[model samples]
Target: MATFIPPGSSNDGADIDLLGKELGLSSGQLREQLNALYARLRLLLTTDELGAWRNESLALFRFSASSSAKATEEYFRVAPRVLDILPPHLFLKWVKRGKALCHDSPGIAAAYFRASPQALATLPERQFNVWLAMGPGLYKRNSESMELAAHFLDAAPALLQVLNLAQLERLLLFLNRLTETDCSLAIRCLDSAYRVFHALEDDERSLFLSIALALVRLKPMASVTFFKQGIDSLAGVTSTQRLRFLTLLAKIAAYNSRHALSFLTDCSHALSGMDRNLHPRLINQCETVLAISAIAGIEFLNNSPAVLASIGPAGLERWYREGLRILRKDEKDGLAYFRLEFPEDGTLERLLVRVELDHVRGVLLMYGEALGGSEIEIRSSDSLADWSLGTIDPGTPATDGTTIFLPSSIDRFDSAEENFTWYKVAVTHQSGHIEFGTFNFCFESKAALFSDSRQLLSADGHGLSDMDRFLGLFDDRRLAADIFSLVEDVRIDYLVQHRYAGIRSGYRFIVQESVWKRPSPVYLPLREAFLEIVIRFSLNGELPFVPEALRGPTDTALRLLQQLRSPEARVEDSAEVAIRLYDLASIIPNTRLPQRDWNAGGSEQARSNRVDTSYRTSDGGDVTIEPGAEVPYQAPTDVDFRGNSNPDMLNIQPTPKDGSDRGTLSPLSSDIGEVQLNSMMQGENLQSGQYTADL
Candidate 1:
């Protein structure tokens, strides 16, 4: 063995001057070059000066090309500089040189061996791992450090068997540190390591696995087992943080249900029997799980008894009740009523309730059928009453009936005190002679003669006041004044003249068929009768009436009535006047004489006093007219007494034997004929002696 020794082998106490022998260069020269390169690279790295470092790396590469055996040495020397410059493209050049020179050149290999570890650490982890796998020269040159390196194990794990406990610990520390920065990078590194590990012999791979597992047990941070520790550590965070963890857990669970469910169970168990303060946080997590389960179409969640139990029956009931209440309120406020025509069947059963008040009043049981051919029959507990209906000739068919009751016979019961009576009315429809049917029931009340003024003036309330207010808007002074006058006159006629006894005076105007003949339908007058009545009554407080001095006021009233009898006058003005008069009559006090004595003549004393009185008697003096038992009178001839009367002109005449005045001729004798005288003369000639008594 001593006869021929390998020159590059480590020999105990042998100093063969290997660098000089192998490279044909002094050791000092190699050391100087290496030192200079190292110095330049260190400066480049520290200062991050790329310009100077590029020139220096190019100069070193030029120096290595001159020596044939120096390629590996040059590669090992330039790699650190290249790493410092971070020229990713040059990694392959250095790797090729490292591979070529790594075999059979001890000094070159030793040079590479000394620099590769530092160069590898300096290079980016990705490129460095690639170089280690492709460049066996770098690996063999730094075989000891490579054996100790986990990063190198990514390329050749078979050599991991050579690493001792301390080397394995160093490998684990580097891997753990690399992973600490980025788990994805660690996964890539571990994946590469796994491929290399599989390439190893079974025994060698087993030894590496044992060391790795032992290192993982001692310090889990270097191993994948630390992921569980990380999850457990995150357990003591806030609800929002917990929610984030749960979301991540759910994503993880999507990929692997077994792992995710295990994690969730652990979290759930940790949450239970712990602080009650975590209830809200735990519940939020549960809700998040439920939402995720729903979105994922997880069948387990839908079929799970736990999820159904969480929502509970009471909560569902509460939600339903709240929805119902909202609906009810909306219905109550949104209800509305409207007016509509009667259908062909003449029924409104399906119409809305509140919107039909006016229609109900006009054609239903609340208001009596005052106008129209529609009848209303009222059925009550006591009795039923039917009201006969009539309508204005030119008016709309009073098929629309209001249901109000009127007594069949309004009996005036003589009671000392007031009496109240009520009657029921049922609204029904009638066509021709047939009764349609009762629709509704209503009641009407009657009161006895009011003894108090308050009862009579109670009309101040109700729609009467509103009607008066409405009439005030018109500015027609003449019409307003006429209305007032007419109302006042009607009131005087009705109350004072003793006309229209026992009848409730009200104003009503109708359009007769004769007035609006062209269209063959009644037309509303230019003005409404009700408005006219309001205006007239408001102006005068009574209807117009004639006076007794002018052949009695009725004759004068009749003359005015006749003047208004024309179609235009009756419809336009008279109708208005009539309505106002009626309204006024209703309000004004009756000053007329009692109906019982209204037509009686004057007393006997009054008649005699009228005959005895002189026509020209002075106000306070009595006239002395001497009474002869039968006084004779004389007619004045053409004395022209039509002129100023003279008290001194007294022409007296004697009385005749018949006591009748001849000058005061009878109106009957003025028409007697001479034939009567001839008949009387012939009879007188025959009975001259019989004419003893002048017959």
Candidate 2:
């Protein structure tokens, strides 16, 4: 059970007064009497001899019931003194310990308050107000005590009402200091103050705004939210009164990029109407905004030309120059920025020129001027300007002509072996004249000088023979014919031979071929015959007699031969094949047969001359006969076989005269009248025999 004491009793007090009074007594005088008493109290408090001696006087109140009231009254009187003696930090600890131990004894608490109201009132107000103004220290000795003090401020209406503008300013300064010391505590303090300021009337709102601005200047991050709240709290303040708030916000904006954009966007109208008198400050703010935008790649100033212009020419130029510098410095993003800014067709060209790539071949091809006319003359070796031109009139012969002239330093002559030549020829028609605007010819080669045309052709002719040998066989008839035709039609004008040596030999021929027509068959069977002979020769190792030497060796010939000789070769015993051969022979009008009697007794001769002479003697059996045959017969008057009679056959017929009687004529002759028979068959037996063996 806990003992209860009146407000001014010793039993419920912390015994702080007893300890203070004992400090005035001599240690030798208290020692003998306090030893056993200190031991017992030490045993109860779980302390040793040192602490027991120090707390010896408080142990006296445990035995005397009247001492509780005295102890509580003394506690109130000494608490303020202890606060005054101790540092602001330790004073909070005393308050908490006193409250915990004496909480059950309300009489003791009332006695402490009634005995020293002035000290009680003054001490809490002094400590808490200082804490509120100066911010929380590094160590919070009694957080609960601090909280209790904060609550006390709410009940102290007189003190709050009496806090003048100067005191509030000091408090604001203290809070700023706290923000620098402890940011979290500064946030809490500002939060509490914000609530208090909002509860104030219009005049108090203005005062609070000033205080908030001061704190914002000192601790922008901590005070930013509170400052905004203060600005909102000013429901009746004019725009002019809000100038300082805007200024503080602008400072906050200047420090943080995100905050700057937000401030600019949220307070755009307010910012625009900002005092012209604060031009320097405003300009500083703009500089910060531009800087952030440049770094963050935020297009804050893009759509607002008015805002950009408001920054003035000098500021914008500085910004632009800095941005360009950044672009030039960063390798990857720099090029990207340049591309975005100056996206023109020839921008790359201009950039290359700046990098001194005017003489670079690739650059020249991409961006340089072209050569034109009969001769493109480069005057000097260094620059493009040192140049001249020569005429290239059409329809005129190009003999000994200067086709192109380049700088002597450029090595105008190039071998045709190492690399190919690329020429770009552009032509345009103006008025009645056809003008070749510009023609660029680029030759990549090894030779360094131009030779005479005749010599060049002679060298080239030898080179061609070498090529023909290397190619193994020049079987391209069309190519050969084309060369022959060219030689026949065009006159030799000029030539240049270029040579190079590497893995293999290389050469080229430049010939001027006059355009002409020749007698060429629209369709030629010679090509088919040539191809057939080529295929046969390739397959069989020998050509047909008709075109043995005409068709030469070629890949097509070889391939055709291989296919024919392969296992999968197609074999045909077709009647169509035979018929085709026969048709071919028939179409050949000059075809002749060998010297032999086809009608002789050879198998073919027998087949041709053997006639199917059938005698159907009213029986089904048929008999065939040869061409020459003889049989016994009588002749009629109309059948005159007298002069051409066969010796073996006898014709018995009397010629009848016009007056003679028809009865006198023989019946045999009349019966066989005008009978026409084969005489060669009559000489031989009527059966079967050969008649014309020699014929």
Candidate 3:
């Protein structure tokens, strides 16, 4: 008669018969073991899936022990996800490696296969095996209950999004490798790892985890910190900026692991307000601290954030790098100075450079408000990122019509007053766009100063907006846009010059500076060089030399723009000027000028940067562009000012959450009353009982 086969597996009786011979088992015993394996899986898998299961369960062949089948059988019932953990393809290999594991602890391999998948989703077969072996040992000495331990295992896949399969394995290995193997760090990893990943790019995640794991081993006792505040602080800092925190962690780990988290938390708090660009400097500062000694490093890191914000990055670097002097004189003295415990005999104050955002905010705001003809909110240029307005360009000021955005600080200038003047120029230019309506031009719109004789290349009556119609004419949208900008800015600068007397000095200074730094006319491509000359001519700017080929259009454009100096010139007139300029630019090709010996004229461009603009003196004096004492500063080229300016804006205020009316001031109070004081005695009660008044 044929041997009776099991209900689930299609493996013939021959396979079981061969397995019995290898393990030195009788037919009856082997059949019993196979029957037990069949029973556990039959409860969970379909008949089709059971075929795959039978192939994997053959790992039982590697084990001759009587209890191997039984341990797996019991564990399989609780672990419905075991198949997910050990895919049928990898089961045979995993089982072979399980020999030593099964020998030391009879049921551990099955217990892991069952318990591990319940917390986290099925990992790649290889990653599963690492966790399979390590899972049982993680909480071996910890107070974590089985369910709580499983809770941490469940978080693996979410973190896996930020970490690769290999990185995930390394993280687990670090915990398992720790002599005490703090399970709480694993729990913290589950809690904040997602957030830490949020702040890091995928490539950066590996390095961050590497440093974290290194900290665990270097100061194994630091798990208290790893569990409490460390991971949360890690989330607040970016991956690139983590070097500072890492070095600071190392110092604290060396000094006393107890202080690491506090120092890390303090540093994160300080970093929260800073720009990410400054992080590299912070790292360099931390290294300098470490170079001094453990105490000195920790102290410097602890106070670094505030010092950085106070002194600025350059100043802070100078301060930290200078600490080597005190450290050389007396390391203890330097440590106290960095910690701010001692002021270092005025050395700390000397190193400090107090620069506040509010320093020039009010002045720039008022300057913009006066020119913008509205109460404009002055914000940092970084705020421009929030606007959906087209390309954002640095160095050019932008306005949303309601707010003028400038660079966050003006360290580019020496004094606060000088910085305010610089900021004033940025605000005034952006505000001028709003006041003069540089963005108001429409296509096919008639210009008041010059007739629009350019033929419409497209259907004139199509439903295109003026902007669309105007922009459609040019093959190069960027070039057309820039030429229009140069013309409009010249008109706006003209208006601001005549209207706001207070800002003319800065306005003239910036315009002059731009002309001074303008790229040599000969170096620019032919058409671009012509556009450059026309722009300089519009600015009343002096150029080193104008190409002979461009002289005709340049002369005509200059003559037409001079009409704008008339009191009758309006925003409409400027639009006409833009149209004329655009016409001149249309004929020019976009290519470099072919010339011999280009370098010989470099010094000439430098000498002729400022052209004699017929400037109208502040007190109704004769216009003159006569040379004055040289104040050297560079401004972006005219192409930069035009081509690189941010898009014309739209109102970008966020939708009000409650949609409350913005028509009126919020009510301050509905009731108004004053309480009369009882001056009879020091301890007199006013209302609890009757009190006598002084007669």
Candidate 4:
């Protein structure tokens, strides 16, 4: 059935001699290896299959010889396994394909055989031949692509498992195109394709490959980062938004493929903190800008969230329309407008209802000075000189004992008059802290209204500041600090109300307004609920329905809170009330109450008007905690008007003497110092001469 050429015949011997000379194999060794190949081919192939082998085997060795000895050696090593996996006719086809590659590059031919049964066995004969067709075009582009072509074959099986035929075709086409510009990047994309496509949904994989194809054609170098980070960019967007998001990118790719991926990256960043509901509107806006200029569209989408927050969605529409008009006239200015790089006082400023602090700094500074009876510098809270003073949240009003820091703008209310009043309210509250001696805490001072509890808890006068020393006495310094801040603010509000009759109505209105913003007590953990209840009572003087289990503690906390409202109430009395409140709050578990306590009408009871005024120790043996009821503590929401104040930080700076230069105060001096209190409190190593505060 088969025509066998004996090994030592003139024709066979001459072929072996040619291959041995090319392969550097001795005559005997060449004959032995050739005979072994024949014996194995016979065992693996049928008599009918031997027809192509008779002609192609010697031709394959000659093809390998045309390349190098290495090519010949690789052929011998993988020929058996390849023969075992592929039919004789397919093997003959494969060898002929290798001959084409060897004509241009024997190294690529060697790599071709090295792919062997593993990469070849994954596909049917037709797909395998299609894969071979890719090799020559790839290596023929550049010598460096020889290795890349080999890698593509090796990774073929894994890719087929994750990607369907259509997606595989798109990916291979993309890689092939990329290899023309950068062979190394193409290889990396092939190596990474299995994992990237595996994680994507079937449809998403198709879309991603399509996007990559469109992207690389315009900007081939971007392919390196796009293949590495494109999936991650998509991952940050919500699932519902991904299809629309990808579609938007695809549209951009159609006209402006150069910036399409850049747009995707910027938009994903903008969406991380943004609401998903706004994503549709954001995408729509991007499309509008894209109608103008692709670059402007990308910059606009990046700034959409901040513009929305600063001036609501309505303002954002107007801003975009204005920028669009500018774009028609002058593209550079239009791009600048979308990028928010234009001056604040420019045309965009008119659209905002915000009252910037720089606009009212002089008025507010004089108002603060007149009320506090001292010069107070008005500065932006975000520009505070010392971070050690702690982060004064940028958009809130705060004071560092000397300078009054306010947000860059007050856009809280819609009207200019209302917003200006808001700035006044902020200044008045902070001035009250300075005027009423809130930060002028003395360790030896006595409470004007409540009995002193600091004596029992004091830590032997070891502290950096008197306020720090007083707060350090309690087991939970943060809780004590929060309680003290709450009580002290109540006293400041009372003094401020009585002292400035003109601002009383506006102050009361703000207090009432803030009451609506307070979190409903029913939803909070028990301890946080108590603190919230006190904050509400201090604001509007009305208490909500309390669960019967917490009625006693609620009433007791109410009594301590009421004392801070006394006309003669001092900062010391605030401290005294905080100590009692901390003791009362300590015994109450911070865990969530049962649904029955909040939902069942029978368990809801009104707090008593007449509460026991007697002081109670923290040792409450009467309280019971259910199993698994304990939870981590969370602080209550901050009241807006009463800006954040840290008395310890205030005392860190020494008060300016009558006529001395206030600029020369030591950072670590008594009554004032610029210090990293947060870091120090977190257990950083202290210098030898630094005072140790228990807090």
lDDT of each: 0.31, 0.30, 0.54, 0.70
Q: lDDT by residue for model 2 over 399-472, one digit each (tens)?
A: 11112211221110122111111110000000001011101101111111212222222223343432232122
Tens digit per residue, CA lDDT, model 3, 130-163:
6555445554533453332444455554656667
Which 10 consecutive positions of candidate 1 have the poorest summed lDDT?
A: 416-425
Best of the candidates, lDDT:
4
For model 3 the TM-score comes to 0.45
Q: Per-candidate TM vs. native?
A: 0.17, 0.18, 0.45, 0.47
For candidate 4, write residues 345-461 as lDDT tens digits. Answer: 645556666677776676566566666766667888777644356555676777866778888876655445556667777888998898888877787788899887788777787
Superposition TM-score, candidate 2 onto the true structure: 0.18
Misplaced by over 4 Å in model 1 are 1-189, 192-284, 287-695
At residue 513, candidate 2 shows an lDDT of: 9
Instruction: Please give, for residues 560-627, the per-residue lDDT of candidate 1 as tens digits.
Output: 33343332221123324433333432222222222332222332222222221122222334432223
Candidate 4's TM-score: 0.47
For lDDT, candidate 1 versus 4, the one ahead is: 4
